[model samples]
Target chain A: MSEPFRFHTRLNLVELLGRRAGTVRELLTGIREVPGASIYHHTHRFLQQHHFLSPEPPNDFAYWISGSLGLNDIGERLASIDTVRYRRINDLRTRYVEILEEALAARRNSWPVCQESDEFHFMSCRTFIIPLPAVARDAGEFLDILGRISVNSLYYHVFESRLWLERGENDFAVWFEARGDHELAGALARLDPYTITLEGLRQEIIGLVRRHVQDR
Target chain B: MSRIDDYVPVAGASEVEELRLLAARLEGKTIRNVNSTAVGGGVAEILTRMLPLLKELGVDARWDVIKGNERFFAVTKNMHNALHGMDVPVTGDDLDFFVDVNRRNAAEMDLASDILFIHDPQPIALVERKGDLGGKWIWRCHIDFTDPRPEIWAFLKGYIERYDGAVFSAPAFSRPLSVRQVLISPSIDPLSDKNRDLGEDEIDRVCAGYGIDRGRPIVTQISRFDYLKDPVGVIKAYRMVKEHMDCQLVLAGGGATDDPEGLRVLDEVKREAEGDPDVLVLFLPPASDIEINALQRASSVVLQKSLKEGFGLTVAEALWKAKPVIASAVGGIPLQIAHKYSGILTRTVEGAAFWIKQLLQEPEYARKLGVNGREHIRANYLITRHIRDYLLLFLSLYFEKDVIRL
Candidate 1:
């Protein structure tokens, strides 16, 4: 129903190491804002096993980041230090987070400003990934924003999200109700995702969103 | 239970009667289904099974396949991938050829019926006849449209909007269309040759013919030899599993009549599978249902490693046989497998390999998943339920003005 979330920073570890932070410690300090544990473990295991065979550079966090985030290109050419030098798990974590940011950054530029579709399925290869700075004022603005783009764009942003699906519809529905959109929340609860057509449901939702948008 | 009466044992008499009552209500309406291919793929298969049953239930139903040449089919194939968001480059020539082919077919074929049902984009343009012709045209999009390429979708959207209604396999498969849209997930017939019960000897015989030893832990993917199915990815995952356990891989499938790229993809798969004696690449002939049924029953684990899929029937087929299925969590696959409950949904080759190895290592857990999987299929995926849903859809269209006094 959806794709992985877009990470914030775009620090290409390979390029960063090659240019700004050659040592793992400096790279760790640079990417400290991004937590390491969230995405590093799986990338670490993949690197531990397939890093040598993969085109992703071994010494830098770029390989782990690129591979983990499904990015097609190997990360930047920032020369990397030996992983043996940093024995602590936090060192690995920071590298992973840094590499993730690098890939995410690359993915953002990979497509058109208003993307028609996703290619490479890397960091920015998601459906409803609009970085909402704040919640919508009402249903109208929300629907207007959602409808401004293609239907696919509207889908991932609110309804068919992986995070929402994983947490179950009730939690999402409750959140919707709390946002003062009870009419939309009730409609969501009534429809079965498997059997309902988004066409019919979206019409109703857009109608409601438009109603609110005009109200303001 | 191969007959309509036979379904009573599994679906229960009352449930079958409900379908019967719905069919009875739809009795006078003539339902005509039009598609691109008649022999290969799921839409054809489902129609083949359902049309006759619909006729038996007293609703006049017919199936027709549109006419197209080699170039037209090739374009449609590309269109199929593009619709599924495969990033394939589809040009103006492709779109023109597709429309030209559909125009010719529309001129030739009699698309007349009370309800004219069009399946997928292959024959979607046929819906353009709705204005000249009089009928409730239902555009049944069986392929995944979750992330369709913008240009291709824009081209198809014109004809699609003309339909009285649309049917998607899942809500995610839907887009913002003006037509009334409903979700009707495709289903497999429990009493069909491809899904019916088979003896142990029959299972052994099918495995023996393919040189697949049934004793070993077998991970099989039953699908068309298309790139979208990712036979190469399945091999990669199989190799990963082989590194851990002494398992065998079976990539068994045949090409559809409509897909010209099948042979080239088959060659690519063979090249990818070269030098691996454990890998069994079987090109089964069409209608080899007994062989297909036997393979699913014989395998310890069934895999559907599709890069993009439109409700992989093979996944449902294997689950109906109560085999532990590990499939890509794309399209309608996740809707079938509940992840660690009925079956497992994997994202990558490594992830698929991990689950295959886990299932092979723990027979008890695999068996448990299979048991749960059978129940899930029984409740959700069998043909009887599909018939009921379709009948209801047809009746709903006809009875929209009424409050259901039937």
Candidate 2:
């Protein structure tokens, strides 16, 4: 028999890299140079931290650009990037670098610099993944455990696993597809996690699994 | 003190259950927290509430207060100011005595816990025993370390680099260090008397007892009497606001046992007040949590106005009460406030006065800000989140790699 799906949760240890950027050129340089973990942090911090209230929280770069540097045009463009579309952090990094380069190309002479204290601080997180006691052997068991596990666990399986770890699809979808449940797996792989709160995402997954079990 | 389950209603059942899951990873590991004082200060206040909940969750958590004499405290106070980037002098003798006190404490205390969590500079030197004691040492720095004095930083850096990890409250407060650094912001206990919801009659009673008229708008700032808090500057801003409208100012907080300059700063604040009946500069005791809660709940606008700060838990406390806050854009205050969205961020006394007047005149706008501020605190800055991060940090010490599965 195939192995059971062991649910896992994560706690992030955020570390400051001691690098900051006040001007657009410096930001682009830091983006290109800092570790991929740092880029992942600035993008996914809001999603993990604001798991309850926010449905569509902007990444730190978008917030800092528009809110601190008052660059609304580029900030909007950065915010509109569909993070769910990319499965690898390096690909995501390439998209952000392209956006910053486009902003600079448009305005060659006038470069915006934020206040001295308002520079963007580069940070990265070392994640500690801990497996939970909850395990799922079938779609029914998966639905039950998914409803009870912490939203943090849901975030890890859905967002961090699929994107930052370069997994083509989330662990849930992979597990089901491995069990010959292609329809459920495809449905889960299509869900946009960035557009909903973690709780809403949990409920949506539960609904899909419950329906799949009934259909089977 | 409230239990872990008591936080269920405020932090939600899922968040509370998550703490138990995280604490499970740290089961059987003894985590002992060491700080300078057992009473007064933010570190003590947090440990007082946090240690019990950790015990309830089956973690062998203990708190120990390091011993220091008057000379030792005075030297540490100078170190504290210097670390906040003040032009305070640190003598050669001062560094000698600081290490001497830590050495004495380290000898007497049990430094053999699985995890020894050192809080702030006062007990930082105890990391010297890590090689002998053979435990993971985490140095928790809860100060504004953005621009620390070179001599004091170099002195502390020797001990700091020996630790397994260092924890800073804000990214701005962190330094480039060989020891792995983590950013865990300080939090507010939402169920504590100091932040708990108060009845209308109780809030009115406390304000009236403090000689504050409940009829007029009240602007309050609750912090220890320290120069870094800028109590005198708070009065200047209050006076500027008073020139525009008829209102009252309540500046209330107590002194910490470790801070020797509190009374002197209180005197400076009283002199600045100059017996203005509208300016109520009351020196509260350590047990004035309910009174502090009532004062914050009754205030029309709250101010934090610190020249330098260490996360400014008061900003989170005020924000938890859904009071529109105008805090200085320093240290971790910026992390708590969203600059005119959740609360207004100010840079000067005049700017604070300007926002105080603007918020007072626009009552509806102020209410919206308070509502949004409380939600931000709920999502980010609560004791539940703090405990989760600490447990994760403790678990991380064992797992040397980036991602470890159970």
Candidate 3:
């Protein structure tokens, strides 16, 4: 008999949050300590203010685990993870490191630093920072993270898979490889950092306004 | 009766009017004109300006373009190259395609006029439809057909025999065809944007925009981006002249939509002029008439170094501006420019460079040549004279005259 086809679900927010729990915890705490800290404080306040202890049933395994541990308690659980699972994660990380090394080597040898301003800068490290208002901090962080992670990872995954053997795939491969260059990726990485700081500052102002509202 | 004032004449307006009056004697006759294109070429440009003038003279003059799709055009383009003495393959399929397109155009077009004029090879097959609509058909060839490919000529001769007469631009371009052939050179409209006088400010502005120094000696040629124009040869001549005389060359022209080989030829030209700072290779758009006029006016000497020319209008345009021209003594150029009198004629790059250096050295001689050239154009190659010739030719079909006394 023919083997049955296996359909795998894509990795979601639950998997990503669980995998990088320590980093997320450290980022969240650093944001909350600063009042009037721009977008950073607002981002932490939004994460901490969510009703994790609500009586509603958790949607999935990652949500249930997250709720049990609480948002502030993720760093300790990540540290206490079993050795076998940690080893597997390390192996995946090493594979990613090798792919990046190969790309860097290719870039160093072949690519020229694009000098013509008239032509589109396809592989440049230029970043544009947009100032976000204090009130729309959580919404801003959500959008900023969504834009950077989804687009950049999608670009990197396409190049790493080498899906360029098909007839029409060359154009797509060129576009993704251009976007996933080190300079372009570095520019995109700074977007999340600036977004997080702006979000934090927005929340502190909102809290002060709320206290004024209650007293009145 | 239609008056001559209704028509816009470029030159020799009075003589044209006199001829039109003579043509009015034969009032009821119909006159027809056949040519390759109704746009982009000199034949089309002349016919567009001349047809109305003829109609206003009480002679019925109509113009027609030969119909051809991309494949037919490609074959005809090869035929064009072959007729210029290039050894190109004119396959049976190419002839078949040419005949098929002509037959199709003949079916759709009305060929019932009294005097039918067939322009070039593209519409030469329309003479096959002459049995049903009998008239005096004239084959007006605007190209050098002295050494056409034998196979292609044999095929075209079957249609050429049907014509009552043939017209050639130059005596050299003529071959011993069965029909009676006449020589009538092409002319230019002095009032047209490419030849008309521009204000000093407008000329200055255009020169500034293109980074052309108005004070420096500018040598220019304005023709379509075709191999026959020999833009690369113009650069060679310019470089040779630059050895002694400090001058800049402007190779300014546009490509027509009908010519498929234009882009490839332009790319080859750009490759040849890789690092030449003094050479300005401008690929002007079709609508750049004023800019062309400005360049010609600003030029110290105008050159048309065509390897093979049907009729280089740039010679007439420069002459109309009273600028001394150094043109190749090929095709219709000799008809316009009389060597050392009206303009200097040359055959090779060395000859052209020699004349350019001479003209730069002696301003008085160059100025006198320019003066003689303007009067020559005024006497022979103006649109007025061209319109008068057609009017007279149309009238002659009905009435036989020993000499046309316009």
Candidate 4:
């Protein structure tokens, strides 16, 4: 099996972080300094920089944010931020933790997230979930990307891969592009062997995710 | 009546009028349909098309979608598989979750339709709310219920008895229900965008757009990304035929809104067809009706090799276009294909492959089969027939007499 395609041209995490430091600093400062702007904007912009958010407006920010940051905090934060109501930051912190826990709960039981069968032409019923390793290693990035893609799209791509790994070829680029994470796509190409079988890649992904999760 | 005539050419204007008259007899009566989702699966597709027609017929038809989070849907999805004879372990929590969601939906929805039609097992428990609703409720089982998980079936039987009657697509799907059972097979709307006749140029343009070769014989199967559709089996059959004949296989389909198993099935299919140059697997959207119609019409032979099927509408759609289809002898497919007379029926990959090779080799036989298949569909499976049957069914519930000659 050929190495999976890598989305990033360079694998240096430090270099990538350095290049993205300005945006990350802007995001952090925006949340801390801006009186009216909430962390939602900062998180969204950070996600967008990582190719998780689309260039289009209303890119599933609510669900991802709500999923990542408990629903109550999101509602309160959005309300306070937009309405300029002075709310304690501690409340926001508590809500964020609650949301993360909920998301984690969803992640735990939502294992093997199946896609709708009517979306594509494939044979076996399949599903996908973010490997614990992948999630732990890049929780923020994962959440950012998760926020951008519709629930249906996420399910569809994952399910498609489960049914026919070759279908992976169809969406590997698009899935990353949608998340604004071309680096991952590049990483896949580099890791994937040209003549590799679908099962081999799936196993590799599963193993990587398991190891990543274990490391965390 | 005029509406039917405008949309369906097979139904005589008078026949359609009779249907309208029957429908008018039931006017002002509330008819509710309970199902899993409002989009994706065939039940949703059929309802989306049928509900408006029922409304046009002066019946107060409404659709209700059951609510479920991912865990709930996952359980129901497993129940669906279990009902189809798959050995899925339905945990006690799964059952509890199923009832919990159904109970919630039952409480939320106004279950007051004069004729309450419950589709499949997903919302079967909604029938539990039948107490003093002062109306007849019908359980419409769309999937193959001939062999179901005994526990699931037994649990569902309690709810089934609450309904006034039950509807099944095939006799095989019917079980020993306490309530009366009505066998009403599914139908295809020949007049719909997905089944309408396209101009030769339009067909050519669609074929060109899909990069499907016009010079060779085309075998197509358009279905959802589900294992029951047996897309991988279709590829294997196509490969077998390719050994002797020069043809192309186009597996074109899309996902539905409610199904959570589509993407995985699609991926598995793609892996199985690796390095196959002649096979074209298309992940089309639900709205690609015209494309589907064009693919069916362009093809010399169509295949629907389903391991199990509620009703393979693609088979009817192909036959409506007078294309010979070879389908698995499962679910509602046998209702459409009458063996060697209308279309070929196969049980295994070898059987399917044999028929595909035979059809490709014998043009005359294939042509006759296509002709017979088209007439069979025209006679029984068209939307006109479907509308008429439904109208009659609605009237029969009131009349109770079988000898109502049209």
Q: Score the docking of each candidate (DockQ).
A: 0.02, 0.54, 0.00, 0.01
Docking class of 4: incorrect
How does candidate 1 fare on TM-score? Answer: 0.61
Candidate 3's TM-score reads: 0.60
Say which docking band candidate 2 falls in.
Answer: medium
C-alpha lDDT score of every prediction, in listed order: 0.66, 0.88, 0.58, 0.62
The digit string of per-residue lDDT tens for model 2 on A75-150 reads: 9999999998897889999999999998888845677788767788889988877777789998888888998887
Which candidate number has the best DockQ? 2
Give all candidate RMSDs, comma-separated: 16.8, 3.3, 35.1, 27.1
Question: Residues B305-376, candidate 1, lDDT per residue (tens digit)?
Answer: 888777787898999899999998777776577667678988788998999989999999999889777866
Tens digit of per-residue lDDT, candidate 4, span A134-202: 131242444334333332233224322322222433244344445555655445434432123223444
Per-candidate TM-score against the hidden true structure? 0.61, 0.89, 0.60, 0.61
Candidates 1 and 3 compared: the better one by TM-score is: 1
In the range A2-72, model 3's lDDT, one tens digit per residue, is: 22211111111000010111222332332232222121111122222111111211111112123223332
Docking class of 3: incorrect
Best of the two (2, 4) by TM-score: 2
On TM-score, the leading prediction is 2
Best by lDDT: 2
TM-score of chain B of 3: 0.89
Clashes of each: 6, 0, 16, 59
